[model samples]
Target: MTSSSSDRPLLGRRSLLGLGLGLGLGASFALAACGDPGQAGTGGSAAGGTLKWGWALPTSWDPVFSSAGWDVHSLSLVYAGLTKLDEQGTAVPALASAWKFSTDGTSVTFTLRPGLTFSDGSPLDAAAVKKSLDRGRTEAKSLVAPQLTSVREVSAPDAQTVLLELSRPDYQIPNLLAGKTGMIVNPKAFESDAAGLATRPAGAGPFTLTSYTQNAKAVLRRNPAYWDASAIKLENFEVHPLPDAATVVAGLQSGQFDVAQIPGSQVAAAKAAGLEVQVIPSLVVAVLDVNVEKAPFDNPKVVEALKFAIDREALLKTQLFGYGEVNHQPFPKGYVGYDPASADLYRYDPAKARALLTEAGHPDGVDLTLTTTAAQGLPEQLQAQLKEVGIRATIDVVPAAQATQIVYIQHAKALFTDQFAGRDSAAQAFQVLFGEQGLMNPGRRTPPELAAAVEQVSRTPLDSPEYPKVLRAATALAVRTMPNTFLYSVPRLLARRKSVSPVPAFTAVQRFEGVTAS
Candidate 1:
C-alpha cells in the first residue's frame, strides 16, 4: 500500500535528540529513524574529520535561481525545509516542531521550536518563515509556489505559531513543503539583497556555507551552534565537481575521494573493489521530447510512430542494466496515484512502426534529426537502436553545459532529456512539464483537458479516496496523447567507504543527516 503524507508525526528540537537513544540498533532501524534529528547518526560511529563527496555536476549554491547541478546538495547542508521525507516517502517535520491541518483541509498551522537560531545568530520565527517563502515566490517563479498558491495568506497567530490560509482543500501541501525548494533562510542575512545572497547563504541547517567558487568546489563547515550539532559528526565536507565518469571512477580507486556517484555500468566494478555501494532507485525518466507546436510532431500519428519504434524493454535491460522499471505512463511505480494498467498504451512492434510511418506519408521511414546529451543515460546506444529501425536518425551529442540551452532556449526539435517527479502526485509532475505555463513545455500549448485535470487534482483533499482515481485518469490521457514518450525511471546510486557507520536509506531523495565517517 502507498504511504500517506500525514501518517508520521513532526519532530521538535528537543524531542529529536531524545530519539538518539534508539541508535546503534541496526542499519534498518537507523535508516527508519533518519527523519528524526535526534535519532540521526545513531548506528554510525563518531569520527570527527572532513568528508569529501564527489559528483559530475558543479555546485551552484543559490537555491532559487539555479535549477540543475549540485545546488540541492549544497543547499541541503545550510538550510532546513519545513517538512522532510522519511525512508518510505512519508512527510515528517524539520524546522517546524509540529503541524496540523484544519477540519476543512484548506489550512495548516505550525508551532515553531523556541530558541532556534540561524547560522548568523538571528532568531528563527514565524516572520522569518514568511520572508523566506515570499522571496522564493517572487524571485524564482518557483514551481513550488503552486503548492502554496492556494494559500491565501500567512499569519503569525502567536510568537511560536504560524497559520496558513488556503483557497482550496489539498493534502499534498506538506509534501511540497518537504522538497529542497522549500528550504528556509534567515531574513536578516538575505533581506538586503536576495539575489546577491545566492552566492553566500545563512540558514539554520546542520552545516554552514564557508566558501563557493563557480564550477570548481563547494566547501562547508559543521555549524558549531547548530541546534542538532551532536547528531552531525563531520567537521568539514567538500563536494567536488567531476564531469567525466572515468575521472570520478579513478578518483574513487586512487583513494582521492571517499564517496562518488558512479555510472550504472560501473556499479559491479565498484562493489568488486569492496566499497559500500548503495543504489537508490530515482524517480527520473529519459524522454524523447517532440516540439508539438512545430510541424510533423503536430500530427499525432507521427508521434505514435516514434513511440512504437523504440523498444522500452531493450532500453531498460541493456542500457540501464536492469536497474530501471519500464514505464509508458508519466507516473512511475510506487507513486500513490500510479495505475499499472496504463502500460498497454505502447507495445513494441517494429513492423507496426513502419506501417504507421507509411500511413503518415513516409513510406520507407522518416528522416529526422534527434538531439541528445552524453549526460543522459545511454544516449549513444539509443541513437544506434533508432537507426536500425529504418528511421534515418542523426544523433547530435551536445555537451552537458549546452544541453538545457539547446532544448529549452534554442527550442531544438526531437531532444532526449531526463525529468524527475519527486512527489507521488501525478498533478505535480504533469503541471510542471506539460501544463501551459510549465517551464519545460516544448509545445508551448496547453491541452484543455490536461489543464482542467490539473485544476481538479490541485483542489482535491488528501483524505478523499477519489484522489487516486482522478490522477490515474489524467495520466492515462497524457500517455495516450504522447506529450513525450515515457521511459523507465532511473535508480540513484550512492557509494560510501565501509568504515562509515551511519547511513540513511536511499529513497527518492538522498538524505545526509545520518551519515558519519568512522
Candidate 2:
C-alpha cells in the first residue's frame, strides 16, 4: 500500500479533536452558486448548480431498515432528524431549532423551527416527529432500534412541540437523535404498507428524490420550497453506488464523479492525481474480537498472549498505510474516558506471547479460526502473525451476514471486525462492545469492575469533573480484561474535485449536504 502525507492534521486525541471539528462546523458555512448543473442560468455565483456525488451505494432506501453508512448518506439528503451531529459528533440543531432537558434529565422537550413543510407539501409538525420515532422503534427489521435504548415514550403536546421521556438520565440522547434513528419520514408513508414504502420514501430535506434505482443510482432535484433555500445551492444532486474503492477513485479522476469515498490505502494515489482529499480521523477501530465463552479464550492468560503477539504498529503502517492510529484499549485514545496508559499494557513480543501460551497449557500450539468479511490481505496477515507465536489461525472469508452469525450467534472462538461508536460518548461505545447489555457481549457476562465503571460514566453529567475519572477507570478495567485485541482507529478519507467544497457537518452517511459545486 502506498502512503502519502495528508493536508489535514493527524488526530492526537479523539475527544479534543472531535470538539474542534464540531466548532469549525458551528462557526460558519460557505456560500455556493445556485442553479441546475445542466442549466446556464444562475443567481449566485457560488450557487445554482448540480452536484454529482458518487460513493458506495446503499442497500436500502428506507432509513429505518438501512444499515450501511452509504445508505445513511443517501437517505440523509431527503430525510432529516430533529438534531444533527457536527463533524466532532456534537449535536447541533437541524429540524428542531433547540431543545431542553428536564432538571431530572429524564425528559426532553424540542421546539421545531417554524414554517417547516415536508417535500410532499405536508406540515412537518410535532405529530410527524412522534410518528417517525415510534415507527423506527416499532419496526421489526430496523437496525437503528438499539440506539434508542433510553427512549421510553415520545409524545406530541401540540403542533410544534415534541417531548421525549427516557428511562434514565442519558445525556447521549441528543447525540443519538442526531444519528440515523432520529430521521423523520413521511407519516403517510407509514400509514401505508411498510414494505412498499421502502421503494418510495419521502422527507423534507434540501433535496427531493426524483428517481431511484436500487443499489445503482438515485437522482435528486432541489426542493424548491426548502426552509433553508439559500443553503440548497445544488439544483440537482445525483448519487451512484460504487462500492469498490479503486473503482470510485478512478471514476473521480476520470471526471465520472465530483466526489467519492476512498480507502486510506488509496489516499496518496488520489492526492497524486491532483484530487482534493479530506481525511476525518473518526472513532472507527478494527480489532480481533474474541468470544470469551469459547474454550481457550475463556482463559485470561490466553487472551493476553494473543494481544501481545500481533505487531499493531506494523499492521497499521502496512495494512492501513499509516492512515490510522494504533490503540490497545476498546475505546480509542483521546476519546472522553479513554486512558492513555492502557495502550501500553501489551507490547509486541513473540517470545512473551509464546511463554504465556505455554503457561496456559498450549505448549505445542493452539489452533483457531479468524472469521472476517473479506478484508484485503488482513486475514492472511493475522494468520502469519499468529503462527510466529505458536498459534495457528486459519482465515475464513464470508459475507457480513455470515460473519455476524459466526461471531454473534454461533459463538465462534475469534473473528476480525471493525467497531465504531454511533455517538461520540465513550459510555455508548462501552455499552455496545463491552457492556453486559452490549450486542457484542454474546454471553452477557461482564467484568464487575468494568460494568460499574461504565454505569458511573453513563450516569454522571458530562460537565462534572468526576466524569473523566470514571471514564479513565472504565478504560483501565477494559484494557486489563482484554475483551479484544485493539488495533487502530481507521481514518476516513474523501476525494473530491477542487471545484467542489465539502460541508463541514456530519450526516449519518457523511454525504455532501452543504457542499457547493463551483
Give residue 196's lDDT in candidate 2 (0 to 100): 49
Give the poorly placed runs of model 2, Cα more than 4 Å off: 1-46, 224-229, 330-333, 410-413, 419-425, 502-513
Q: Residue 219 of model 2: what lDDT?
A: 75
* Candidate 1 error regions (>4 Å): 1-5, 8-47, 56-59, 140-148, 224-230, 375-377, 421-426
Model 1 C-alpha lDDT per residue in residues 67-180, reported as the tens digit of each score: 552345556677777766666555666777777788767888887777667776677788888777776766544534644566677778876778878787655666666655
List the global CA lDDT of all models: 0.62, 0.67
What TM-score would every model get versus the actual structure?
A: 0.85, 0.85
Model 1 lowest lDDT segment of ten = 11-20
lDDT at residue 448 of model 2 (Cα atoms): 80
- Model 2 CA lDDT for position 234: 78
